[model samples]
Target: MQAKIKKVELRNLAFEDYKQLKNSMVESYPEMADSYWRANDIERLLGIFPEGQLVILVDGKVVGSALSLIVAEKLVDKKHNYSQIIGDYSFSTHNPQGEILYGIDVFIHPNYRGLRLGRRLYDARKELCEQLNLKAIVFAGRIPSYGQYSNKLTPTKYIEKVKSKQLHDPVLSFQLSNDFHVLRIMKNYLAGDEDSKEFAVLLEWNNIYFDESPRLINTEKNVIRLGLIQWQMRSLGNLEALFEQSEFFIDVVSGYTCDFAVFPELFIAPLMADYNHLTEAEAIRELAKHSEPIRKRFQELAISYNINIISGSMPYLENGNLYNVGFLCKRDGTSEMYTKIHVTPNEVQHWGMKGGSEIKTFDTDCGKIGIMICYDVEFPEVSRIMADEGMNILFVPFLTDTQNAYIRVKHCAQARAIENECYVAIAGCVGNLPKVNNMDIQYAQTAVFTPSDFAFPSNGIKAEATPNTEMTLIVDVDLRLLKELHEHGSVRILKDRRTDLYQIKKIEN
Candidate 1:
């Protein structure tokens, strides 16, 4: 036997669903009937700002509703009763230019309470708040269970207890869990509230992603999605095999809607096995022969897959000199290269390569970014210079032969993220290629690092792949968080730098 279908949806409030909405609110708040909105009031709300009125449906039944209005941030600064603030239920206080979403009411039917419909309504409201790019959501939240402790504790004391988890008030507890902090305690905020004793808590949830600048463009995104490919080292007979493998990873990451696909440095170096009879320097030089064609092919892959490709560091023969290089193959079919600025001692001794003298950030459709190859990230100055260029993300494509070497790259990359106040994503080659000279062993643990702060991961690592594993790590980092961190983080390392004491500047090559 087949089970019944249950479809749930959230949508703007409608006058036609007033009956269902009324039923849900009436049952959700039996203690606040006198405060319920009337038909003409709902009409006025719809007439003023229909978008802010939202409802959630469970199988075509209205199970929850959230009503809100935009008001100037200053309008909510002082104390005011619910009726006075909402203009006596007429919602005349709504200001289209306002940056705050003042929540008038939110309720879910008792029948659907077990389904956590309140959370659904709140999440929808939060999404709408972000879509409108509002500053925050403010509301007078009811503490229905306050009457139980009214005799023993003051409202402020009770709120403190609830916030500390020493006490539990269903409404306030849910709001606290949803990241809404109690701003203040209000006396006589509502009338005829026996449970709340005519008192309420002013709660607020700020939109950390909020922007003050007027949005002239609608499609711009502050959150960037990245795909890190932890490649395995394997010898191949020809270039076609390597291209096939590269395309496979690109396909997988793109399937998940990644904005950019990144491969580890020298991930294609296994092709060097073809010149095994030659010296290490000679074989790598031969590898440089494929750089131009590989870049063009990767460009095609980027456009075809609809993802930007960071074609990991390669050997480039330019002006009769070898330089390690990487390409940023944008989805628009445009591409640019950032040559590795610091060659490791092994790279210099084994391949007779010189580091590229040029240092700059690359501009993409997403935002400004910098690409550092292996040892370049080990030097704080390289990233510090790029950070000055307003780079949002720093990508490090590295290859390390052992865990110790990988740790140096990893730890330094993390430091760069914190000090620069930018996201740092690093990918590397894993596994081994014993048959390929100078590519005999590999060690890697791919990870995306975020600025160390309250808004980001506690340990600073967002997502990481299993050690020495051939896998893809896809993660999203918000550019807005970096902005907030720079301007208002607990420890503003980027802003607190003692510039007068020391400075980092790029010298012309």
Candidate 2:
């Protein structure tokens, strides 16, 4: 589909573009040809809220568009037919001061159906909802394929089939793919939706960043699902190739609705193929040059996939000093970095790396998290300090070259989970990068750990991937469990600490 070669954009809908859009609407839905948008209707939408009307252009022509309006929750909070909500085609329901961004209609030209042009329009609507601090993206979407199965299945049954992939409804399937969930099966929503059999699905995509303080639903998330990659050391041709591989994994996990995705330390070091000619020390410094680009790309992915990413650890050279750093790229398009506080003797002697002293915790949609790089996990003091700061989860991105080293990381991680009474997730690279010097061999087993006691796994391991193989381990950890363990569990580790005798001092430089 030459999509890579095509130039696409989401621009404001203009009065002059109405004719082109009408042709697209008719072609995409000939059954509703009489319901084609009028020039006056387009003008009214623009006059009401110009930015709410958006168009997707491919190569300078409108191929798709999304029409929306800000509406009060009280106005359309209950089920109402299409005519009542859209004010009989005059768009009278649009309220400039409303809190919900209601999607009135979205369509892509028939010729552009499979190109994901509709998603662009939907994504743009979500961005708008976020930008305006709207509560959610609400719409009634047609289940156009329902008519085919109407003789045998009810509207509810048809929706269940579409959701489970047993059947495909052009409109409902596409909407579901965009992260919209069906709230209810609406009946007679659209009077003449013959293809849908006069039924529709009430779908919604909530704005995660909706700020009442911009604060999340509560003080803490109940459960958070994590995906950790047991990465294989591959010889990459370039940084883009490495990012493409990362994208594939992120997309897969996002499909499973993971809240967080963790990559192994030095995952991008595979791109070091271009600099393998240099000395190990020089080659790593050359690799550190990709810090900004790596962070930028990962940020884009976090938003695109709607998953929080602990971008493993990367070579970060700062002020003529080499360091290991990882980024916490939030789904809301923001990022924070955590540096490896304790560098191994091997790193100091061979790569001339320095240790970071600043210890911190990051607040995410899930809860407060702390990042500890490979060797950093071995230092119990760092984890304790973060735990003292109310960290609920700690992520470790390591690059070990031996099974013994991997074991040390695994065991220490479990100890941290128990001692700090928080979840610990560790991921590392496996296989060998034969051509890349100083990083030719790796040994790893990805795993997530929980505090040992009642209400948790007996072995202290929630889930683990097979050793020395490439795969992903997904597990769910309840933050509330950690809280219970802290206050009322068999061991009350966080509450039992003898603060009067000693404390883990975290000094900032």
Candidate 3:
């Protein structure tokens, strides 16, 4: 008869499950004369690391358990025997600062055997290792069937045969099938396990996701150069003309040592010059028609220049509703869009654009970043939420028509930088668009901002272009410095946020 595990639930081991776990262990390993784990031993392991302890439940009852402890890599390198590593199953050497996970014990009830409960427990261990970013999972697995062949074959010879598929040992074979590799065989690893002649196999499962590179140690060495373009507005020409104009900036930025290039909000409004004779609403609809081609060109430009490009905010039509959207085109040929979450009165009243409801931060090789178009940056909550999610930089692309309008965006962006302890980069359209209807006037001074702390520039401005000039401003920001500020800055705004008093929760649509 096949074992049917009905209603199997996997969860963290709680203190209350100790009794059922003990019963399962006793029933699973009946061949042993003494208890595999004492009550105090279980309690000590749980007390030290509750996150590493997980139990499998069926019908609200514990059916299996897997316990693990973190240990230093050097400890595993020096110790060969299981008893020496685990300190006689007491887990006295568990280290919270360890970089490796040491699997102490895994057991399933006899009645629950063949139900793949052991596999589930192992999967949970693998996930825990990933979450902790551990180096690897190392454990001494018993060779239960080795005792029967002890008289005929040596431990090393037995292992070679099992590895070669000539023989099968229950524990080692199961581990091998689960992507574990045998490091070597150990003698007298387990004194009480007579089934394996007290021998064990040293096995390891590496966490491939764990990055051990030493690239991020020096914050100064990790710098991302950005190019901010204060694009000059001109009359709309053919698509070829607009493409050529964009390619010129891409070409110039590619000549420099920069990782990303940014354009301003409504940078493509110049393309709507032909329809400028029409009403404001008609011209916006016409501008939305070029959204797809603009996105494709930006993607191609990103790939051609081998640089990440924030294509800036454009009038985008989706599902018959227009939105102010920014396209993030990565050099790897992937792209994502960020819609303006907050619509201005002028935009809503004149252009029929509605505010977006979703907020997203894009993950890059440098770090996590978020995009907030003009009015969105004015709200403290938007930038605050992004900073809370580990975002190191916030990109704002604006289209202000007056000096006062520009100052509003500038002051709000600077305030966000100071409050969130994050870098803010703003790129905007400069010069006038006489032929274009609602977008005929423009004013901007593209600038990269930093937090107002000792670690950053005194004025909080990393680099800025001359006001209303059609030029690109290049600046290299250090990611390591941003991380350091979060921990040791003059003020810990992100860390010191009073969440107990008031919490900002996202209202999902």
**TM-score of every candidate relative to the true structure:** 0.62, 0.58, 0.61
Q: Better model by lDDT, 1 or 3?
A: 1
Residue pairs with clashing backbones, model 3:
none
Model 1 lDDT tens row, 1-509: 11443887889989998888888778878876655667888889999999999998888988888999999988899888888889977688999999999999898877777677788888888888889999999999989999999999999999999989999998999999887988888889988888999899999988866878866774457888999999988777788988999999999999999999998898889888888999999999998999998999999999999999999989999999999999999999999998998898899999999989998999887889999998999999989999998998999999999999999999999999988999999999988888788888999999999888999999999999999989999999898888778766888887788999999999986
Q: Candidate 3: lDDT of 230?
A: 87
lDDT of 2: 0.88
Please identify model 1 stretches exceeding 4 Å from their true place. Answer: 1-218
Instruction: Kindly indicate the candidate among 2 and 3 with the higher TM-score.
Output: 3
lDDT of 2 at 97: 79
lDDT for each residue of candidate 3 in 17-36, tens digit (9 for 90 to 100): 88888887888889987656
Query: What lDDT does each candidate get?
Result: 0.90, 0.88, 0.86
Which residue window of length 10 is worst by lDDT in model 3? 213-222
Error of 1 at 139 (Å): 24
